[model samples]
Target: MSDTLIEAGKRTIELEAQAVKALGERIDGEFAKACEMILNCQHRVIVTGMGKSGHIGGKIAATLASTGTPAFFVHPGEASHGDLGMITQDDVVIAISNSGSSAEVITLLPLLKRMGNPLISMTGQNQSPLAKAAHAHLDISIEQEACPLNLAPTCSTTATLAMGDALAVALLEARGFTAKDFAFSHPGGALGRKLLLKVEDIMHSGNELPRVEKTALISEALMEMTAKGFGMTTVMDGQELLGVFTDGDLRRSLDQGIDFNTATMIDVMTAKPLTISQNRLAAEALGLMDAKKITALVVEDDQQQPVGLLHMHDLLKAGLV
Candidate 1:
C-alpha cells in the first residue's frame, strides 16, 4: 500500500509537470500583449475569478503587486453585488475561469466594456465567451487533470498559476524591478533585512566601539576586548584606524612568550585590517566576515576614519545571517 501511494504521488507530479510544460509552449503574442497591457496600465490591475480560479487569481494578483505591477483581487461573486464599483476605466481587468464562461464573471463584461477597461482572460477554452471578449486571451488549457478520475482542477489550476507567474515575471523584467525594489515591497520579510539593513544601522558606534590607542599595552587591548565582549579591539590613533587586535592575536602573543604587560598594540595588532563603508548592507558585511573567516570588521567613513565596529553577532541579532 505504501508503494502504491508513492507511485500515485509520482504520477500526479508527472501529470502536473506535463501540464506546465504545455503552458510554456503557449506563451506567445497573447502573453506579450497581456504583459504590455498591465505594464502600461495607468491604474491598478483588477483580477477576478470564480471558485478554484478565484483562489489562483488572488495569488496571481499578489505576485503581480509584490513584483512591481500594482494589482488587487476582486471576487466575481462580490462584483455582481456592487464590488464592480472598485474597477475604473483607467484600470485593467484580468479574469480567470477554467471554463471561461462563469456567469458571475461574464455578468461584469458589459459594464467593463462600457467603462472602456481592457480585459485579459485566462481560460482553458479558446472559443469560450470570456476568451472571445478579451483584449488578450491566455490559453491555460490542459490535456487532463492530475486526478485519477481526470475530474479535478489540479492540472488546469497549475497551468493557470504558472501562466500568471509568467505574466508577472515578464512585467517585472519590462519594469526593471530589482531586488532592492522587491525588498521595499516586503519590508517585514527576511529578504528586506538582508537587502535594506545597513552596517551603520547595526554597527557599534560611539561608546559601544571596542578600541584602544595604538600605543596601549596588550593588557589594555585585552581589557577593551573584554569590556566590549567582541573578543577583539581596534587599535586606533585618534579617529584613524591603524590595525586590529583579536583573540587570535592574544593567543599568538601567549604562544610567543611575550609579556602582556610590556607588549604594545603595535607589536600584536594585525596592521591594515580590512574595513567596510558604513553605508554597506549588513548582508554584505556578513559575506565579508564569512569570506575572511573573521568575526568583526571596522566600519569607516569617507575620510577613512573608523566610525563604527561591526561584529558577526550584530548580523545575527538583525536576522541578516
Candidate 2:
C-alpha cells in the first residue's frame, strides 16, 4: 500500500510538471499582447472566475498587487448582482475558465464589453466562446488531468495559475518595480521589517539612552551602562559627542592597571567610535555591528550628536537577525 501511494503521488506530480512545461512553451504573441493590454490599463486589473479558477484568480490578483501591478479578484457570480460596478472604465479584466465556457463568467462579457473594458481569458480550449471573445487569450490547455480519472480540474488549474504568475512577473519587470516598493505594500511582514524598520524606530532614545559626561569617572559610565542594560555608554559634552565607553574598553583599561574610581571617560573611552544614522534602517546597523565584531552602536543625528543606543539585543528582538 505504501509503494502504491508513493507511485501515485509521483505520477500526479509528473503529469502536472509536464502540463506546466507545455504551458511555458506555448507563450507567444498572444501572451505579449495580453501583457501590453494590462500594462496600458490606467486602473486596476479585475480578475474573475468560478470555482477552482476563482481561488486561483484571487491568488494571482494578490501576487500582482504585491509585485507592483494593481489588481483584485471579483466573483463572477456576484458580478451580475452588483459587483460588476467594481470594475472601472480604465480597468482590465482577466477571465479564467478551464473549459472556456463558464456560464457565470461568460455572462459578464456583454456587461464588460459595454463598459469598454479589455478582456484577457485563460481557458483550456482556444476555440471556446470565452476565448473567442477575449482581446487576448492565454491557452492553459493541458494534455490530461493529474487526476487518475482525467475528469478533475487539476492540471488545467495549475496551468492557469502558472500563466498568471508568468504574466505578473513579466509586468513586474516591465514596470521596474523595486524591493523598496514591495516593502511598502507589506510593512507588517518580515521583508518590510528588514527593509523599512529604521534605527530610530528600535533604538533606545531620550532618557533610555546610556550616557555620561566626558569628565565622568569610569565607575560612573559603568553604572550608566548597567542601569540602561545596553552594555555600553556614550561620553558626551553637552550636545556634542566626545566618544563611547564600553565593557570591552573597561576590560582593556583594567588590564592596563587603570583605576575605575579615578579614571575619567577621557582616559578610558574609545574616541571616534562607529555610529549609525537614526534615519537609516536597523538592518544597516546590524550589518555594521556584524562587520565590526561589536555588539552596540550609538545612534547619531545629522549634527553627529548621540541621540540613542542600539544593541545586538535590539536587532534580535526586532526579528532582523
Candidate 3:
C-alpha cells in the first residue's frame, strides 16, 4: 500500500476511536431521560433527520423496530410536506442532527410541539435550537470528523449511530425481549431459522418415519429402512421404543452370518439410541447428531413417545448444517 493511503487509514481509525470514546463521557442524565421518555411513549417512535444524520436515523429506526420497540423513520424534508400527518399526539419523535440545526429538521419543531408529540433530540451541540426545543437531548458530540477535509460527517455520524444502538439495546433489556421475539421480526434471516424452527417442523412424520416392531425379522426392519429412505428404522414394542437398527447393523449382521429371516429386530438393534424432542430446535438436533457421529435420530414427544424421525440429510436440505 502507498504511504498516503496507509496514513489516511490510520487517521480515520484514530478519529473514529476518539469519537466513540468521547461518547462515554457524554452519556448522563440526559441519556437516561431520553430512554425513559421513549419507554413511556404510548405510540410508535418517529425518527427524523437530514442528510447523513437521516441515513443513521433510518438504521436506528430499523434496530428499534426489530428489538421490540415499534419505530419508523419519516424524512424531515417530506414531513414538512404533509408527511407529518403520520405523526400523532401519542407518538414520540427522535430527531437527529449533528449540528442540532439542520434546516429540514428545525422546520418541523413548531408543528411537532403543536401536536403535543414528545421530542427527543440527538445532536452534537446541546445549546442548538433543536436541542433546546426537545423534551430530552442526547449529546452525540464528536471531537473531530474522520474525513481528511474535516467537513464530511464521519466520526460524528459514527458516534450518532452507536448512540442509537445503545438506546435500542437498553430498551430491549428493559422490555425483557428474547431471541424468540427477535426471530419474529427477522423471520427471513438465519437467526429466525435457528430459533424458530423445531424438530417437528423438519422431521419425517407418519408414513415417512422409518419404523419396525421389535418382534419383526431383521429382513423386515431392513426393508422398512430402505423403503423410508432414512437409512435407519426404530424398533418399537407397542408404544415403547425398544431399540434402533441401521444399515451398519445390517452389515455387521451379514458378516456374523446371522439369518435375516430368523433374527428379530431386538436381537440386531442397538438399544437406547439417541433421541431428540419434537419441541427442540432443529439446530439443537444437528448439534446432537454431530456430537454422537450419528446421521439420524428419533424425535419423541413430551411423553417420550416417538413422534417423528430426523436425519442429517434433512438438516442439510433445510440449510441448518
Candidate closest to the true structure, highest TM-score: 2
Per TM-score, what order, best first? 2, 3, 1
Q: Could you tell me how far off, in angstroms, the CA of residue 310 lies in candidate 3 after the best superposition? A: 1.0
User: TM-score per candidate, in order?
Assistant: 0.89, 0.95, 0.93
- Give me the overall lDDT of model 1: 0.93
- Minimal lDDT window, size 10, model 3: 141-150
Candidate 1 regions with alpha-carbon error over 4 angstroms: 2-7, 187-192
Which segments of model 3 are wrong by more than 4 Å? none
Scored against the true structure, residue 225 in model 3 reaches a CA lDDT of 78
Error of 3 at 7 (Å): 0.2
- Output the lDDT of residue 292, model 2: 99
lDDT of 3 by residue, 1-321 (tens): 699999999999898988988888877888889899999998899999999999999999999999999999999999988999999999999999999999999999999989889899999998999999998999998767988788999999999999999999999999999999999998778888899889999999888888889899987887897898988999999999988999899899999999877889878999999999999999999999999999999999999999999999989888787
lDDT of each: 0.93, 0.92, 0.92
Q: What is candidate 1's lDDT per residue for 1-321, written digit by digit as tens?
A: 999999999999999999999987789999888888888899999999999999999999999999999999999989988898899999999999999999999999999999999999999999999999999999999999999898888999999999999999989999999999999999878999888999999999998889899999987887888998999899989878889999999999899999887889999999999999999999999999999999999999878789889988888888877
Candidate 3 lDDT at 236 equals 92
The clash numbers for all candidates, in the given order, read 0, 0, 0
